[model samples]
Target: MRSPTLARRERHDLCDLALVLGEDAPTLCGEWTAKELVAHLLVREHSPLGALGIAVETFARLTDRAMARLGRRDFAVLVEQLREPGLTPYALWPVEVLGNTLEYLVHHEDLRRAQTDWQPRENTPADDDAIWTAIRIGGRALVRPAGVPVRIRRADTGKEVTLRGGAEPVTIIGSPTEVTLFLFGRRQLHDVTFEGPTEKVAALRRAALGF
Candidate 1:
């Protein structure tokens, strides 16, 4: 089984931070407090149909209702539930690795980058590789909808991957971890830069990126 070590680490760390900052602490998830964010995670894993609603627009109301119902539980209990991979299909090793590594990492940052005093967190080489792999796997799907070609570059190794194909692609430059966060929709909070045609760059920037 591929190691889901990064997913596990981020899960633990995110839960700890959620508790330390208390339920009302703000997060980068568009006005979701730490409490609401924790509830969302809980619903995503525990409720299969609810998780489906997350990506399928038609089922969004269902997801919203599930989150609202779970959000009423004690915040600490919600966090504890998320501290583990849980009993759902998400707990399967391969699924956990491919699906959750970036999910937890990005959500972790949603809590972190929202703080008044925040800085880019450091990552290990293994974690970097995992995040880069995850980007290669899921990043394209997130960016392709923008209709502009997109490429992402790792600032450290300079490794590049085409997220979308076109005449000219917007190249996003950052560490893999930051790039992962950027592509996942945390725009202003990440330390990444863009390069490409000015008009194309502006359009992509103005477009809501990430899933």
Candidate 2:
């Protein structure tokens, strides 16, 4: 039997936590509760029109409606469906690993980090490499709007990637997992540190940092 992909592990873990935390538990997806977050995931996988809206702002209303519809289901039902989804692209191993790994990673933390007693979970080197790969590929898009030179460094490996380029590049330093969170807009909750010009760092504080 094939071992589960990172995405599957994250997905299954998130589903487990969501069930334990219940539907109304807080999440980092703005004001969304666990139910809302799960609904969004379901819609992203199952609703053709809403899926487009997941990343595109123009179709947000459609996604909202779809989520609202899904949100009406029992919380356990929603999570179970996500864990054992039928015919969803995320169920396919390749797509699950490539497309959903980082997505679920961030969302898992979205739920995890919201609790008061939350603690940082250590990521293995393999998982760090997986997330680092995602940062190398997708980090550019999330950092581009900042408009300043941006570089991310993995603290342990000393490996680096440039996300956006310009003068006085800001170097974000941390484990890949923390860097991923910071890049994905969970700036305050991340363990990452930065090295850059005072002005550039200040500008980054004010700028929109992620997708």
Candidate 3:
């Protein structure tokens, strides 16, 4: 819920942390190195431009070409280029601004999940509200519940948002960053704490699977 400027600063904080964490850390996403996650972010940052259809087509073609040519040794250089100033314009509309931010914020949380040494600036109530709404929008592409309600509560502030009216509610309680990582599918359910019906929660978890 930080200001756009503050949010960008937060992103930089994570960038520095990733550099320190090294590419070989055990990330929540399979065995991906922190560097690889940043590479994926770079790809997403440059892929969105013009209309959704055009943007998608262009991104696919560009990514294929880039992946073929860039290779692992050159990935960091490419990522540095894409993360340069004013690169946000290349992202698709809506996604360019909001989705990109959401993407980074969630992954940054994922990269920092287990470490107690790092702490993201706490999100204010207003910031939390904005992120809550933004995630609900982006999460649609990610989560499709089969009529099961899921409620998320933030640790920084005692704020709760509920997606209801399905089978039963599967509530997850944790810090906002942890919740974000879980919802983004970077972290496993084993890393999360859940309450309510186990079967229903499992079904909802299956529906909420992340990439």
Off by over 4 Å in 3: 1-3, 23-26, 48-65, 72-76, 85-87, 90-97, 114-127, 145-147, 155-158, 188-193, 206-208
Q: What local lDDT does model 3 show for residue 39?
A: 56
TM values, all candidates: 0.94, 0.95, 0.67
Better candidate by TM-score, 1 or 2 = 2
Looking at candidate 3, what is the lDDT of residue 72?
66
lDDT, ranked from best to worst: 2, 1, 3
Model 1 agreement with the true structure over 20-41: per-residue lDDT tens digits: 9999999999999999888888
Cα RMSD of all models vs. native, in order, equals: 1.7, 1.3, 5.0
Pairs of colliding residues, candidate 3: 1-127, 48-90, 48-91, 48-92, 147-166, 147-167
lDDT of 2 by residue, 87-148 (tens): 97777887777788888999999999999888887988888898899779889888876777
Looking at model 2, residue 161 earns an lDDT score of 93
Candidate 2 segments whose C-alpha is farther than 4 A from its true place: 188-190
Evaluate all candidate structures by whole-model CA lDDT and list the values in order.
Answer: 0.86, 0.86, 0.58
Q: What's the TM for model 2?
A: 0.95
Q: Rank the candidates by TM-score, best first.
A: 2, 1, 3
Indicate which candidate wins on TM-score. Answer: 2
- Local accuracy of candidate 3 as per-residue lDDT tens digits, 1-211: 5335434544675677676776565455555567656655565555443123223664565554444343465544644554543545633345445645566677667677645454544676666665666665555444554356777766556566675544567777775555666677654323357788988778766764543
